[model samples]
Target chain A: MIGRMAAAFAAGLMLATPVLAADPPAEIKIGTLYASSGRYASISMPVHSALKLWVEQKNAEGGVYVKAFDKKVPIKLVAYDDQSNTATASTLYNQLITQDKVDLLVADSGSVLTAPAVAIARDHKMFLFDQTGTGASFFSKDNPYIALMADPVSTIWPKPVADFLTHDGPALGIKKIALLYSTNEFTGTQANAVRKFIKESGAPVEIVYDQGVPTETTNYTVIINNIRAKKPDAVIHLGYAPNDIAFLRNVNEVGVKFKWMFSIYAGLETELLEKNVGVKGLQYVYTYVPPSELDYPVNFGMKMPEFRALWNKTFPDGKVEFGFNAVAGYTTALVIEKTLSVATSLDQMELRRAVFSLSGQLKTLDGTFALDETGGQIGELTPLGQLVPNEHGHLKFVAVYPHEVATGKPVYPRP
Target chain B: MPSAIRHLLFIVVPLLVVFAILPGVYENHLMLFNFVVFLILAQGVNVIYGFTGYLPFGYVGFFGSGAYGFAMMVMHAHASAPVAVIAAGLAGMLIGLLLTPLLRLSGAYFAIANLASSLAVLHFVANPALEDITRGPYGVSLTATFNPEAAYWAALVVLALTLGVVVYLKNSRFGLALQAVREDPVSAGMAGVNVVRMRVAAWLASALIAGLAGGVYAWYVSVFFPDNVFSGTFSIFAIVFALFGGVATIIGPIVGVLILYGVYNLIGFTTPQYFQLIYGLLIMGLVLFLPAGLVSLVTRRGRHVP
Candidate 1:
């Protein structure tokens, strides 16, 4: 009996030897930066929360499955506050790469903060999924490790409006155009793209006046005076939410009405604009990005209704509003999940290869993921919308341009 | 112990040793780098405010100017990092000289005017019309000169020079004359002190310190925007740190940075609003109780702390 017991123990020890030889990591580490308390806090904090929620939800469902490890690995997320400063973002990113040893890296917000991370990601050969950093400079041939998860390249943000101008200008008797854009990277890039596009279009449309305004310019009186002097039939304002709202309020106060007033970011900030400028003030103000009410398909795991439900549940009493930032965050998580499923191994280099491998084949809640070698979005097109009163007597963004995505017909020659 | 020996042992040597060696032991080099920056800036504030009684509300202007100066040299001149850092110092002195006219306005007027000057500089750098040179609001990238270790040591060297100046001011008669000017410019002038000249010198020295700190900071971070370097938080933090530790002393700013910046890292990043609340309460308590700063606890009993 003693001899038999000894033999059985030896056999058990042999079985456990292979198991103890290599210890698998407790969880797959996902590291990211968040602008928790600075200028970008409102926009970036939600992205971090959404990413966290995705990880928690995945962990509940037995975590991500890695073929290389041949096991389900739970995600351990390490996030740092960047204080909405690029210097802080770069430092924290370096920490994430070196100290945290994160398996996957993600960017927080727009290109200003994301550009440094893009450079670092390329240098380290780390896979970076940029959530909303759509600056065209972020995806050069030199910096190819990063993939913009959502939002089209900022350069082409004005393309839909350009298309609208080229197609509808002659019929609407809108030929003269005035261009005003904020000096910010996103706005400036869009303004330049629009200028190039219009110059090359050879349409009857003529740009009367073009100028770039500082992002912090609260009073648009001087620019409004210039625009009134030019008397352009169509005025295009490309800027962020604050710039858009401020310009709208300033133009309204100055009584500088245009036949066609197109502004970016204002239409998406429906609640804030309505409260600040009133519902009637935003009527006929056109923008590029689609609003939440649009019947955007559930290409990723969550649809619009489900996303709204999750958003309301997570942030009740309108503490956090649902908008493009939240959608981009959610879509980024879905994309990462799909990428993980397709990746050959858990290695960072292999994961980058996997992102490129599944580029055109995948689609998210936003739209089809068509990224080129440098990770710039080549196929994503923003739907143009005009603000009009809906059945509820509230101003809602109705997709007007591009017949394929138009929820309602656009009203031209503002009242 | 002699004051010079005390400063060398307590202030200078410890900072050099710790900042140099800590990067090896502590893998968080970025955090350490920031700590060094705040230390230099706080001391720079002490030089202007604690020694001369002139509060520089726009100290970050010099710092931001230095950062841009460094970037411009690299981008336009293709100058080496060390050469660019020297130019950055000169740039700060130039800004200081330009703002000397504002010194005629005393107290709150000077503070407000100084603040406006900083904002003006920020707008100038961030303007799109100057995008050809300053890169405008798009910011500057110096990845080529981004050697963190080299920058870290260079920062230590700057800190050493800053502390050396402070130590001299504490021990030498020039510092006593500056204190006299702070107490009464008319009396200092009657006592054969060149009040205007002394004040200008101190102002330029303060600017030089901040400018050098900003230059090293840009090199360390490698990528930043106008808002990043010209943030009002730098001025606020430097002033608060100097005041909290009881300035006019070498050990004060050093101690303030260690305790407060340590607390900041502990709680400031995760939930900043809460940290801001706590810090606000602490500042109120400090003003009410320890008006002379934290070092008063040691100095109140007729004891000199280093």
Candidate 2:
């Protein structure tokens, strides 16, 4: 009887004692929005695929280390399609916050969709990693929870374009400027930035005509006639791909002459522009080159060659070639991983502080990952590129501005 | 029980009950809010297309106008949500009145004209030339009146009112006259029906319902670009739901929404292309086999649908 009692007591004690958790969490749940369908799908789908690829690569390499848990945890992405609609994006964001209980919130695409999420993230006190949203309004001292990880603000995008015109316009006898921009936020911001810079810089430039056209403007004939009447020395367009393509085709058909021509989003599609406009047609057409096109040395585990190789392997035949959008997505994932390494806890506040502390300390494939107090990217700068003919008689984007990054000289006055 | 009372008990009450009780039973407020929106929109479509035989291709015009109406009221007039919603309904009615002239045209022409008008409105609202007033393409954010709970309940109230209207249409002599006008305007005129007035009234009422739904939607989500509210998908879904279930009946749209929207939420977001393909096939099948809608399957032997 005594022996049995002792054995029973020992078993009860063993059962009552708690067992320590041995390994780190199997995965960290990261939630993001996606425009899997609708208008923005063509641009957003590739970025999302690249994001998945980055996460898969990290998991393959034994997962990412979390300083908070002092352990390695693989990432698990919980994504919802917003259908490229702002309301849907807002609704999905609420779900991500209240139901999914995501550890982090990353934006899908565009300022229009992501802007509403800023309020949601602030309300929930969740750390938001903004990807493609480049609205200057997104950054403010009032909301510190949001951080811009990819794409420079649109306000600064036109600065380089303006700088080129300011320095080279007079020398090339370019006196008058005609600026037309889409009415959407992205193009509107660029237009405003250009105006502000020109007005402040006092670059001896006369703005002959400036107007904002509807984003869905299919016919540019009337506008083109008005612009043709203006007889400007230079013409600059700030718009999306479709708008740019339509305007370019119209200009080509109308035979509008300009000493200089620059468009914001045209360079993103080098191959398409080459195919549509041809090498001769593209002469003197200027655009800003995305970081992915630059032959920069490897930084933060990514180089242009290696990134392209991986992209080809992963997508195989994706309609989207590796460019700004893909590189931005990959860089965003790297920034998230870097933040996780420094975070002391999974708590949103701690994570946000860690991200904020990464201001000038981190470097990624894009450039130095430095952010201002309001979460505006202060370090990364895009290089300007102009379409020039190669030996093969094909149009290729050649870095042409800001002498240091210039791969070829600017060929002014289409010859 | 009378057919009207039967519908109220079996269809209307149950739907209202489900929507009202859903927030507590299920924590997905966004999903529930969307249900209220579609319910109101589907019933709105039934009012015009089902009864008056006018296909409203740009039905989302009223919705977008209402959303902007509510936002402008709150932003400029500092009006309360209730007041804004009233303005929203008025906005839709006003736009409907402006578009009443298009009713003179018949069939595809009217549809094309209506679509063009809606697109024109979208461009006008989104134009930076009007930025000072409408905020242009930058979108509107009603952070001041951001209350999902209130918006959800308001949406339910709108649904209830819409259902009441559907019930009235299902049972009233005026509705019968509208149907007569839809079948043969000359015959309805000969039968002493005020065909023009009745059609206009139904058109305005349809616009009002969608407008109110839009107001509540804006209130619920609290932020939207012009594209968000003016999307053609709303018109397509509402028409499909009404057509799929059976127009002219109270239960059809409700049933259509519950089944089709349920499927939409299940797989639509995850794999939209596949879901779209499936949805297209189903719509085609419905048109070919079930011409009278899903309700016809039950009411095929000369039985009344609701």
Candidate 3:
């Protein structure tokens, strides 16, 4: 009886070996747990599509060489939706790591959703590259496995906006300013960062207003009335798409004017501006970004067309409007390509080490940023960008910061 | 000994030993602790529905508010968890007492009222008017409960006590009275049952259990952001387990939890989530054909088999 049981046990152990020994695929496939569904679907679906496009483009040109395999291996990304819910995102991230055993992971939008996924990545000894969803605190926190490709919310156009303030516009002597931000995680991060920047400068700060309002409340008349009453030097509003449009409409309709009106993220997403804010509404809203505006660096103004053309030809129909978000989305795939290129071996540890090393020296379309230990990108970039009228009567980039980058001098007092 | 008691000892005792050794389970299995917390919560819902026949579609509100209330107090005041548990229970009781007036009404109005209660609380907590106190949209985390095992043990203890309460209620005159009301309100009233009083008590008991579970969960997860804590998922767990596990049978919930958790673990439970559709299909089938639940179907079959 004992001999028979031992024989059965040995058989059971032998049977499990096949499943365990089923080595992961030769190609480095990253099963993505991004938001391809839910409200965030609009943002992530395009991002996954754009990422796949970049991968195809890279492969067609030349494959990424893996040092481990001593050969080039094509990368594959399998995408899924989190429904923009943290629990679901957490659950999906685990599946990607344990079952699918994705070579690498990409984070979905929103810090609230990404936090748990980051913990899971750390546990599984996998690299998670966060792009597009900017939350400054993620960079502020310490983690090894997670790397930052996503521009931190605090740095969402931080350099251009701040450069405009510190070097360019400060000399103009527009003293007091009013600060307004869409009440959300993204805008809150920018609002806090900007306030910190202003506070340290001691630039005769105005008491106009620095407040946040809900996404609802269609009528900004009451709040605008309050802001108009304060009558400070400039009016700054931080928001994304709809709020950006509604804020501009309410303030402009009420005839609220300032020397400068600044905005954050969504103000810079060109499509969001046209389809939502339109040209007339967002005429003078300024946005801030690091000197390296696009994900791929354009040291000179000349690079914009090639970048635009390549991006447009790739997604052609996407040209009605595009901004840093798409660029950041595209950059995530670029990071994977570069990571695979540097890894001397297919071993997970070697791949991770190569990524960490390769990422530190990356010069992206948006300019160069050093990848730090916690996986956040750090670039010595001048923060500046402003919104101006495009020929189509919509808002377009009018650099108004860092004196050097300013396309033209500041347009003060509204028009 | 009764065969049922023998069955309980055979099954429950071993399960107890396994749960006792659960802290040593792989780190990946930590999410199972979430269901232990969920079981306690579902039991609370069971009291309101199974024992008293009150369909509450909005218990998530009570659970969330109780959690946030207890967690914030502990964070701000540096209170102990044991103390916070009681405080959370009291907070839920207060909400139940406040909502008792709605119980005087009948029909779909009760369902609407319960759902409305959750929405009202959600709006109040989410709005900026209470921003200073609740921190508005930004939720407070329970940083104090960093020890993983402590959280698991705490959740387990609370669950045991809640089950004890359910067992006690089952053997009492109150349980008989509650069933009497559930069967026929007019008959219960004619027989001198204080239906309103009994319903109110059940609501209070349910709220207390919900509150205790919420506090435990908040501490266990170490973070209880408002939107996530107050989500409809909380209420759905209560409704799903009860309906799926043969409502009114106390042991039915344990079986429901086992099957549901197994499915969750298989697909939706893992990182790359895919089982949400399967979950919906399973629940839909249960609702459409097996209205009485899998347990009831087996029992009904057994009665006819002879």
Candidate 4:
């Protein structure tokens, strides 16, 4: 009788084993915001499109593997358009968290749009996959609900530029510098970093002109004339794609050429800048060497050549251009995919841990994925490079900073 | 019952009760919070443009000032959220007092001047020269003081107060005199209406309502830049909502916000791809067809709206 009773208990335990494991969800809902129009459209559309490409590719491949359920689950993307308005973005972010209850939340493209999501995500205890908002103010020791997935934090982004300016600049006869930036988080932080880096380097360079114009300032004829009066050897104008387009176009129109000109978007969004400012306008301009040009070896996701081919085929109409932001979006998608494969469950903190765990271990098309203790991205640093005209008169990047990666010598005193 | 008391019971009390109970039933408290904010702003517009006949094209200046005021008090003084909110209101009033000279202008001149003033304030706040004080476009992050629940309740209180003021204007002699000034300042002046005082009083009250709303908003978001708070959309949306519902009536702005902003959110959720086009068309149609606003449909038939 005892043997028979033990056999029956063992049979009952076997029957309940399946129930002990968590059931696989029908779909993993990922909520994010995008700006289809207004100020950020040029930068936002590419990132959003790249994210869509990843979603389609994964879904076509029967879905992604989630370790939590130990099975493949389809992705459900819940997205909203904020029209680049912060108040609207704030409302939509709250809607994504409360009403949608998505498993993962991703921020919009730029710092202006992402500012609203940081607070909203933290308030709801949802982890935010910040795409390209490199604002210095977002990361702190207290906030654990946010992590930057792409682009180095602004505090460290300009290291290559500063290093080049201080270490290699004086030898190249680039001593006097004029700094101009649009007054916003992304570029403003970069400007501050550049200033700090130069001062700390104790280089012979002296900053002759430093000024910040409003982000909405479109006319730069007066500002250009002001900078011209200082007669600096090198000029660094930190601004958005639109600001860069206006500033460069104004430079070309006004017929004043600086010896050394550096603008952020000239290399970062080369296609867009070339189309707007024309190939001649971007010639010999110094900018960051984007991931598209670097060809970083990847442990996962498509390589630069494959991704660019796919981006062109997917967006053949050419309304949006391929650039650094395009690469950034795919990098973020890879991080999410890898995180899901390793995360034990869909809990917010668990997801955060899974993300942080991949730091220094994961490599993608952008670069090695790494994060600081405060969740700021510390990897994927871009080297300072200059844009020079190739055989076909189209601009190509020539990495000139950090001598080890130096592809060519600096071209000073534009003639 | 007095007309003001009746309006309060029928309009203000029910609205407040519904909003007060909404967070428990619906999960999207931010959406509800936003609705409450627009209601206050639309009514604030009604107070000035509806009653005093001055179009505050730069109404967002006071709102932005209030937000900065709250930010300064919290960051500098380390004051609690409630005290910062009070300071925000005072900041708005101070700006209103400084611009009192604008009252000398009329019609388009007043409107353009107000708009320019708001833009001026935005530039001043965002200027990198003020980096030490305002953070100068680097943005503000108030993680320690972030209390969404308390801020939502404070917003509700501000809404209730705004509604009460509107109800008083609808029933009191002071309201009548302000409307009199709006209709014809010269005629009202001959009739001893004290045009300047009435207009300024209404303007200051309008500014205070927006200030309180802005303070609560800043407290709720807890992280923002100068651009976010100073966006011209605030002024544009408030004006559009008040105009759509037929300002001057207490319930008109509320109804307009509920219907229009509800549609706005619905479009944003359902068909976001065409949101901008559809919304633009809807506004143009409203102006072309329903020039006087939705309330005009009923008032045209010799009926009181409120």
Number of the candidate with higher DockQ, 1 or 3? 1
Candidate 3 structure quality by residue, lDDT tens digits, B1-306: 753354345544455567777647544434556667667777788788887777888898788778776776787777887777677778778788888987876667888889989877766665544656765555454545444456677778877777666655665688879989888988999999999889899889898888877776666555435665677777887778867876655566766776886576566534435556777789999989988877777787665210
TM-score of candidate 2 on Cα atoms, chains taken together: 0.91
Best by lDDT: 4
B175-248 per-residue lDDT for model 2 (tens digits): 89999999999999999999889999999999999889889987876666777788888888898998899998
- lDDT per residue, candidate 1, A210-316, as tens digits? 99877777788888898989989999998877787788898889887788899876655566667777777788888865536564555557777777788788778
Worst 10 residues of 2 chain A by lDDT: A269-278
Compute the DockQ of candidate 4.
Answer: 0.83
Poorest lDDT segment (10 consecutive residues) of candidate 3 chain A? A294-303
What DockQ does candidate 2 have relative to the true complex?
A: 0.35
For candidate 2, what is the interface RMSD? 2.9
Better by DockQ, candidate 3 or 2:
2
- After best superposition, candidate 3 residue A314: deviation in angstroms? 5.7
| Candidates ranked by TM-score | 4, 2, 1, 3
Candidate 4 residue spans exceeding 4 A from truth: A1-21
Per-residue lDDT tens digits for candidate 4, residues A310-387, read 999999988878899999999999999999999999999999999999999999999999999999999999999989
Ranking by DockQ: 4, 2, 1, 3
- The recovered share of true contacts, given per candidate in order, is 0.24, 0.31, 0.04, 0.79
- Candidate 1 lDDT by residue in tens digits, B1-306: 888878888779988898899988987677788888889999999998888888889999999988898888888998889888888888888888899998788788888899999888888887777878988877677866867778888889889999998998898899999999999999999999998888888999999998898888777766667777888888888999998998899989998889887887766456645766777788899899998899999999999875
